[model samples]
Target: MTDAPRPRALGRKSIRPSLVPRDLMGDEELAGVWTAQVITLLPQAFPGVLGESLTGRALQEGVWALRTIDLREFGEGRHRNVDDTPAGGGAGMVLRADIGAKAMAEAVSRARGDVPRLLLSPRGRRFDQAMARDLARRDGVILFCGRFEGVDERLIEQFGLAEVSLGDFVLTGGEIAAQALLDATVRLMPRVLGNHHSAEEESFSSGLLEYPQYTKPAVWEGRAIPEVLLSGHHAKITAWRQAEAERLTKERRPDLWRDHLAKLGRPEEDREL
Candidate 1:
């Protein structure tokens, strides 16, 4: 087996912000590293939530790495203009293709064109747990955070950028979306969560939402913890959780429930009764 990666010498207060994709080209020491390069108009928004809790701990340990490519650095003109009025005219301006292309090309060149290039756009494929899991297995990912009304479509096609969406909703910018995506993927990395199975058992791992959880209190407010959960019988508890998960999915997300049935090619024991 390959040896585990040696953690970088990083501290909470010692973290330095990168102004450019200077090391866009992967170096020997970074080989096999699960890095995330975020190209954003707002660089400060990154490692925002990612620098907290378990994800933060993992980052300091070098289980993964983050770098930012400031889009404004590549903007045109004396004022560093990155946006312009939309083609054919629109109420709000759109990000310029030249700027987007330059930023993406530089990032891709640094990675030697092997990394997955993603653009955060609402019209892109819906982000899901499966996508997060898939990304966790990659060497690294490059994210382009669009601002203004949207990005120039030509740049996306020219760079072959895969647009990905957080949901059916809209966001002002892609910084938050990038952070959210990274958070989901990073936690799946080895040693990040401490308990790898925790990731597997969480929502969408088994194509269903997670079962409800209860803590120390045997009774809360007027409600007692489920008797099965408190019984300390591992087998019974597992079965109970499976049943609840199935029931909840069927009631709340019939689409997932149907897909789950299709994958299994038959009903699960929980649904049999």
Candidate 2:
């Protein structure tokens, strides 16, 4: 219904390199749109991957804030045993409900106070770019990363926690998925990415995967950037991008196409299936 973008504009590009990407050319920076608090058994897990990549550097510049909570602080005994066998004798241990709950409470207490508290679990809400965009608009969020089998179900019910799952499959711990969620969420914040349009045009930005992108020498191994991109025709370029996105969705993700049409209120469009 609209070509206009969200109203926030970019800030000056002259920020010190300490607060900006070293190689980023002069461009506007988005400031103070989000803060993130991550509660994890392993605080070291983050900045390991995030530090070297796009999102990590975004943190360095103060475009966003990241505060980590060490869940082991709530563990029992000196060894900080935070997980135990399930009461019914499951093969794997479930992260202790009480410990995790205590950790969650302390994490929220230490967080910005107004930020939303969320536990990263299979039981959590389904994560998607739309959801990512939604969460990024907030002041900040608290993320609880689980390990072993999972955290206690009672604690989740008690706190009315919002469950979030990365996908159908399971991972070793929620920390990685939390990071993935963090990366996806933070990138949508006002100025973390060099180009504001980047977030607007990426996969799921408009309910479709992105059009193919190409750069440089134009011709390489007989494959060239789409001629439409180089034609200097803005309308044609836009049309080509949209058509390619639709085509890619039709071929690779018919489900998305169905949803796209469903959103348009055209039930008859289901015939494309």
TM-score of each: 0.86, 0.84
Most accurate candidate by lDDT? 1
**Model 1 clash number:** 2
lDDT by residue (1-273, candidate 2, tens digit) is: 877454333233234324435432112223443667788888877655666566766765556766677888888898999888899886989887788788777756655535777777776667999888878877788888888888888878776678889878888888888878888888777657888988889899899989988899899999888889999999999999999998898789888899998898987978958
lDDT of 1 by residue, 1-273 (tens): 997565344322223445553332223234456778889999867678888899887776567778888899998889999999988986999998988888887788767324799999999999999999889888789999978799989989898999999989999999988989899999998989978889989878999989999987788898989999989899999999999998889888877988888788865533643
Among the numbered candidates, top TM-score falls to 1
Model 2, C-alpha of 250: deviation from truth (Å): 1.0
The superposed Cα distance between candidate 1 and the true structure at residue 204, in angstroms, equals 0.7
Model 2 lDDT, residue 251, Cα: 86
Model 1, global lDDT: 0.82
Model 1 residue 257 lDDT score: 88
